[model samples]
Target: MHLHPQKSLYDLAQQHHLEGLTLPSLLALTKEQEGYSIDKAKRFLAFQGRINNEMLNHQVIIQNPYTAWFEQGDQNPAQIKAFIIQFSVFSNQFLIAQLHKMIHADTLESMHASKEILANEIGVRFQSGQQHENLNNQSSTEGSIDGSRFSFSAAHFEWLYIIAKKLGLSFAEIGQPKHGTHATLFFCNELIRLYGGDNYQISQAASYAVENWAAAGFWKQLIQGLQKYNDQTGLDLPLGFFIWHDKLEAQHAAHTQEELEELYFTQNLDEDAFIQNGNEMLAGVAAFWDGLEVQRQELATTH
Candidate 1:
C-alpha cells in the first residue's frame, strides 16, 4: 500500500512483490490492503468533475472569438485553407504519439488499448469490438486485422487531406511542418512530450485531457462554420472528416471516463502531478487555437 511518486500500477505491484497479476487481481489486492474508502472514491469523482468543467469552459475553444467567427459562416477561403494546413500538420504527427503511448504502457491491457486506438487512427476497423486479437498485427504495412484491411485510404490524416484537396491545397501545402504557425508546431511538439512521453501518469492525464477537449464540441463548431462557408461560396467541402470526428469524440467521452476510473482507482496516482500535466497540455491546445485566431483576425482585416 506504499505510494511511490509517479509510479504506475504495474510498478507498484512489482514493488509489492505482486508482479504478473492481472488488472482485476491487482485492483482487488490494492483495495483490500489499503482498505477501500467511500471518501477516496468521492475525491476521485470530484477530481474528474473538475477536469470536465475546466474543459467545458476552456477559453481556447469555448470562448475563442475565432470559433464564433467560424461558426457564423462566410469565412474567407484563405483563412479556411490556413486552418486546414495547420490542423493537418498536427493530425499527421498524432500517430507517433499513439505509438509512444503503446510503447510506454505499464500493462498488457493498457498497451493493447493503446494499440486499438492506433489501429483506428490508421483505418483498421474492428468487428464486434474484437480489436485485441490483432494488436500484434503490423498495421503500417497494410496488415489485416480480423478481416479488416489496414488501408491508407481510411487513415484520419487521409481524410483531412481529402478535405484539403477540395480547398485546392496540395500535399506539400497540407503535410509540411514548415507551413505550421509557431503555435501549431508548439502544440504538436507538446503532444509528443506529454502524451507520448515515458511518464505514464502524465501521458494518461494528457490523453484524458485531450479526449475531454475533443468532447467539448469543437468539431461541431468547425462543421457549422464549414457548412456555412459551403452555402455562401457554393463550394462543396466534404465534411465527412469533421462529422466522423464529432461522432467518434462523443464515444470517446465514455471511453475517457472508464480510463479515468481505471487509472485513478487502480493506480497510485500523483494527483497534483497529473493535474499539472493536464493543464500544461491544455495550454498547448489553447495556443494552437489562439494562433488560428490570430490568422483569422489578420485575414478579416485584409478582406
Candidate 2:
C-alpha cells in the first residue's frame, strides 16, 4: 500500500479496495517462545530472503517511466493489490521473523553488555557517541573487504559485558556471544539510537560495518541456537545439524570453487539497497512486535 502524505496506512488499503488489508491489518501469527529454536530462525531467514528477493524483483516489475498515476489508469487492479501486500505489512511480517534469526538473542545480550563497558571506558554514558581517544588507540583495528569496520573500541567490550549481565546471560556454560570488529562498532552505534542516547545518529559507515562484521557471528549463533531450539522443541535439530555440517564439509571437498557462493553474495550486493531494505524491514517489523507482547513476556518468564 502507498504510504499517504497524512501518514496513515489505511488510505492505500481503501485505494486498493481491500477491506481486510489496512494499515493496521493483523497478522495470523503467534510469538510463543515454546516454539523458539535456532533452526527455526535459520530456516525462516532462508525463507524470508526468498520473499525479499521476490519483492525486489517485483519492484523491477512495477517500473513506470511515465510521470502520472492517471497515465497508468488502465493498470490491472490485481497488480496494484499485489503491490500493496508486498510493500505493506506482509513485508514487515516476513522481516520480523527473519530478524529473530539474524539477530540472535546471544548476540543481543552480548552486544548490550559490551556497549555498557565501552561507555565506562570512554568515560561517556552508555550508548553515547563520544569516541574514546585512548581506547581507540588501544583497540586493534580489524576489518573486512568492504572496509566499513573499525576497531571494537575498548568501551564496547565493557558495554557488552554489562548488557550480558543485565540480560542474565552470563553463565559460563551459556557463554558470551561471538562478535567481530564491525558488528561491535555498528551495534554500539545502533544501540545509541535504540536506547535514545543523545543525537548520535547512524551513518552509511555504520551500515557498512554491520554488513561486513556480522555474518560469521550470525552463522555461528544460527548453528548453536538451532541446536538448543531443537532440544526444546522436540525437533530433529541435532540430526539436521549433523547433516548440514556433513553436507557443507562434503560440498567443500567436492566443489572446485574455494568459496561457496551460497554462503553469501558478498562483495556483489547493491550495498545501498541492501542496507536500506534490511534496516527498513527491521523498523517495520518492530512496529508490530508489541502485539507479540504476551507471548514474548511468557517466553521471558519461562527463561
Model 1 / residue 273 / CA error / Å:
1.5
Clashes of each: 0, 21
Candidate 2 is scored at a TM of: 0.19
**lDDT for each residue of candidate 2 in 115-197, tens digit (9 for 90 to 100):** 43233333233222342423223322211112222333333233333323433333241212222122222333343343222
- Backbone collision tally, model 1: 0
Cα RMSD, model 1 = 9.1
Q: Model 1, range 1-303, lDDT digits (tens) per residue?
A: 457532566775666554433455456445564533344555665676666565545676457666777888867878888889988988877888888888998889878878877887878755454334322231332223446667776677888888898889898888677988999889988998999989888898899778878888788889999998999988888776787778777777766766676677668888778777888898999988989999888887553
Off by over 4 Å in 1: 1-36, 49-57, 129-146, 301-303
Off by over 4 Å in 2: 1-48, 51-117, 120-137, 140-277, 281-303
Best by TM-score: 1
Question: What local lDDT does model 2 show for residue 168?
Answer: 39
Per-model lDDT:
0.75, 0.30
